[model samples]
Target chain A: MIGVGKVKQYSNVLDKPLSKGKQEVSLSAFAFLFSELVQYNQTQVDNIAELERRLEDAGYSVGARVLELLCHRDKGNRRETRLLGILSFVHSTVWKVLFGKVADSLEKGTEHEDEYMISEKELLVNRFISIPKDMGTFNCGAFVAGIVRGVLDSAGFPAVVTAHFVPIEGQQRPRTTILIKFAEEVLKREARLG
Target chain B: MAPAGPRSGDAIFASAERVNAELFTLTYGAIVRQLLTDLEEVEEVNKQLDQMGYNIGIRLVDEFLAKSNVSRCIDFKETAEVIAKVGFKMFLGVTASVTNWDADGTCCSIVLEDNPLVDFVELPDTCQGLYYCNVLSGVIRGALEMVSMKTEVTWARDMLRGDDAFELQVKLLKQVPEEYPYKDDE
Candidate 1:
């Protein structure tokens, strides 16, 4: 047991400032932790959709917090105003901060003006994951999609985000595409403001 | 008056590499909150966290072995020191102090003054029975079990739960020898 006297000697961590130092954690540790999260959520839900919903719910809170923190850290507290600006922020800044690299590409949907896609050749969260045959069409990237939804929703651009796995013939790491569909109201507001 | 050898364990930990503290804390918070909402039972949540930690520990030990160049320790005392100095520092960027060793040296406590996982956490009043940091104990138990050392680990105190300190008690029950069933055929 630590003595009360020792506790008094140490300063409270809350009093310290959050610095802008380049901090990095073990990827293996995070991969293992996330794997357990998927396993736990899998045991709780009956179907793949329910499991993805739960994973998204879990990532939602994180996305909200990350949005606030990242805005403060990288943008000087200025929130992105334009749709392309926010998508760029999510594609480049958010991806770099979270995964230590920029996403592969950001493309506009062919059929819809309000739809956008962000693709990653290899998602950090799914580095150590291997889906079983029983879990048909299950993509752990739903957590990342949930985060994207949370960030967009909180930033006043309400949208629905879904993750899809697209395997390349010769690539070792499979690609994940996050399809983001913005609400009609958002598009109307953007058009009026533009 | 200092012994002429390698520097002390704590000194080594002071120079360890660090990770983005927010990523560690936020992800852990998400996991805990999810478990609470899904299970709705403190005991079940605790069990689930431990089981998850056990699974993580089994895989984590392999990573630890691969990254660390340290050789095997001679005894349990040295083992505790290695775990505190190398394992915790390498993974979490924190050095736990090994203290309160029993007279027989079969049991001791690892005291963590700084825990990244609890940085943004506050145990809710409803989660009275939830052992928020029980995963640490489970990891210790699971990791030690892999090295042929059967041990029991429990949290003696947790700062997140309003305790004065964070202390994990590890007791070495016995050692089990490895058995190869195919050795006779070979």
Candidate 2:
């Protein structure tokens, strides 16, 4: 709330300068808050799938916001128009700011050209809560999948995003993978742009 | 290195693992939006938010105790001070001031001039009855209860409601003796 130059009145949020993404809070604070989010949603829904859908919906809005905020602040108002450009942005820029680091790996699907996979050993939410079958894989990743979808969709890339459990040979818990399959129009547009 | 005396709010905040505030702020906003959509009633949303905050407070108090090494034996007055100075700072990266204490020292206000929760937030005309930050009051109440202090916390003012600042009024309702570590030293 520190004023920039002198005492002034801001009639709206738009009037305020966009924060430089410098402010911070302890990781525990966020973890506690996020835990409550999942718990509250759980009470509202009857089954696990419904609960995961609700969590995804919640994350969608956050992803949408982060896209707009980061684009304006960091990219000098230039948005990624190409498929690779946007995916890279989501991988490096969006993931870094939101999760504190780049995602572990972003790989193109060998069988399908229209799909991409983003894998993380332990996503932020996965590290805190223990899921039934695995840690970050099945239940905990829906929200993150939603975030990726939100970013891609709002950026005009309309895609179907899903989360899956990938078992490591020696690891006790399976890591999480986000599978993103782009719509036909998006691929058509990418080909046109190229 | 652990310092000799109790660490200040700034010192603990500097050392703790941190995350981007925008992520936290956006995540909270998303939660509020989801609650409003599901509950429909503003009153119900407030209650749910408070309940969630209470859950967090009960768990967070343990971390607060472990991190902030203040003298254990203190009265309700000092306890409020620590929560304002340390608890808020350690978690939210903000500092609040404890003021306007009653003559008996059973009640006071935690005044926050700048709050991250309210940033970029404006009360829509339809949500006039919503105490958007009820979760904070619930957190204080639940945290105090864990330490054997039954308390009542309410919002006296909110910036979204056009108040100059955010103020939470906390009243010490009862004190049960059960090997409480934060008893007053006399």
Candidate 3:
């Protein structure tokens, strides 16, 4: 019987000779599956907010576990502090851990000094997100936000993250902006430490 | 140590980036299928999810507690607040604030300023009149219960409105056993 621990080992036994490279997968399957997942969750909940909360929780589990595993892998040496340090970690470490590529853009919030925005143009979760007019409440990109939140908080960067779709008229794909706002205490602490 | 690839090496341990999105979807599908096979009733599905989340929450508390080196919350009231700010933020990227702290201040309302999962896309037509997804409510309820705090999750806004934001209210229902229930299982 294979347990959760063995699942990783099993992959190696079957594939043999694992190498580091990009693996292409069918976007259709994920889209369809996510579509159904939303459908399934819909039947069980009472409202749209509930559904989004459910999806957020689902992503939350991934974030929590992923954060644990990633920290274990990285040897958990130093904790992250300050905005730029954490952003770099998100861009290089968390992005590499989850999406394989560094995000397309990492910009500080122009309006707010404390807020930093991490934008991804070709987000995998949003590739097939089709918000129906009737059910105007759902966004699949919350999963990515969960992951980011997980990684950042795990690394000791306390922040609030929000996902939004900012459409660029000429841009081919939707640009997702993850607004990360660090806690005031965190900023204060960073200043003291720096 | 060599870096792990998606297919080979310790994917989680090696920080592999080559993971195929399809495989992640497949994993999600497999877990849901497994759950479905064991559970039939809609209520049962929700129950199982809560049960599973309860277990996860117990373990998660241990991890977070260890990493943050945070002392146990002074009370379940504090525990609920911590979960919303720290627990939710750590995993979901959204910090739910206490919009309506109860008269007793035990039950609190949490407002979700941003949700990452629903970033670019929108829920389709078929899912209307139904709760978008409530696994989170079940999870929070279950996890807090495990930690000895009874809580119920309610939505502040309906998602069908195409409103720019989403919010949820968590009501503390009862005080749970002081000792976590899942401790013996591990």
Candidate 4:
């Protein structure tokens, strides 16, 4: 319905709808593209950390865009301002929109008030990827971590976000956990909000 | 209701396992942005994107063959139609139109009115020379090559560069003659 009454053609994308997120491509298409992203970055970097950083950086821009788009489209432009509010938004809203479900768990770090973790068993990006033994602890969850960071940073809750694999005693596949530590200013502001 | 016939692209797409378009859209954006930062040259990023697409295309053609059920012996004209109509629709959820053939039946233009790749994308001033959708061309080339049809695909128009539509000029270079079942040599 963009440029509804106007005669202008090639209506601006700003007027274009999000199509209610109904538009889709096959999951394999996304998986193949993502695998290419990983392979392409692997060729560009010398070390695992750098590779993860590159992937994270790629995901950050996505996170930023997701935050902006979802806020405008889903929230009617009202943003999350509190710590728990923003965290819940990321855990439930962002996760659901991007991955088709809420993250498996969101838990606060027992040792620190400012740190939290969002863990997913079989994270979507990691579902089809099996890191070679030689790659040494490289988790594709770094991309998801970057996404959470991007969302938090843009929504005024700056945090240090990193992805780690936490091994379970019985299971062969470890779960990926995104650990987020809020910045001092964010904590201060949250304290005041309370 | 599993009706078996010539399945429309929409039916195949609707039945396939799906994900949010925004996830795909934003992920691609992030890849482009990261490429621009790391490669530091728009041309290199475009080349890399094309190469990545080529790799993906060769692999995806198998899935395409299995799902679309396109006949293997179709002529180049029908191939272009399949690519523009079925191929694009099945993978990208958008249909492209074939146009402007030069009467040889070996070359034509594919015009896309809606491209998911360019959604919410505006080319920055620094990337004026970038073929933002170079990957699409590479995918066409690679996928065609897999079927033994060599092709040259280039951007004729790009909406990101202010063109009204996205167009790819596809030229069929050669079709390798398929010889099978161990030909007996003299």
- Maximum-TM-score candidate: 2
Better of 3 and 4 by TM-score: 4
lDDT of 3 by residue, A51-87 (tens): 7666655665556555554455463655455568778
Over A1-194, each residue of candidate 4 has an lDDT whose tens digit, in order, gives 12122322345667655558767777877898899889988988999999999888888888998999899889999999999999999999999999999999999999999999999988989988998999998998999999999999999999999999999889999999999999999999888878
Q: On residues B30-65, what C-alpha lDDT tens digit does candidate 3 reach at each position?
A: 334334554544456546555544544555555444
Task: Give a tens-digit lDDT track for model 1, residues A1-194.
Answer: 34333543224544545546254455556776788888888888899999999999888888887888788777899999888888999998877777777899999999999899999887777766888899888899999998889888888899999999988899876799999999999899899988
Summarize candidate 2's per-residue lDDT along A61-164 as a digit string, tens digits.
Answer: 98888888888989988899999999999999999999899999999999998999999988887778777653223376888888998899999999988888
| Each candidate's fnat | 0.38, 0.66, 0.08, 0.64
Docking outcome class, model 2: medium
TM-score of chain A of 2: 0.91
Q: What is the TM-score (0 to 1) of candidate 2?
A: 0.92
- Assess every candidate by TM-score: 0.87, 0.92, 0.47, 0.90
CAPRI quality band, candidate 1 = acceptable
Error of 3 at A194 (Å): 2.0
- Every model: iRMSD: 4.1, 4.0, 17.7, 5.1
By TM-score, the candidates rank as 2, 4, 1, 3
Per-residue alpha-carbon lDDT of candidate 1 for residues B35-80, written as tens digits (9 for 90 to 100) = 8887899999899888888887777788776666567767899888
lDDT of 2 by residue, B53-160 (tens): 899989989988888877664689988888888889988998888888999999999887457776667779888889888889889988989988999999987767
Total backbone collisions, model 4: 0
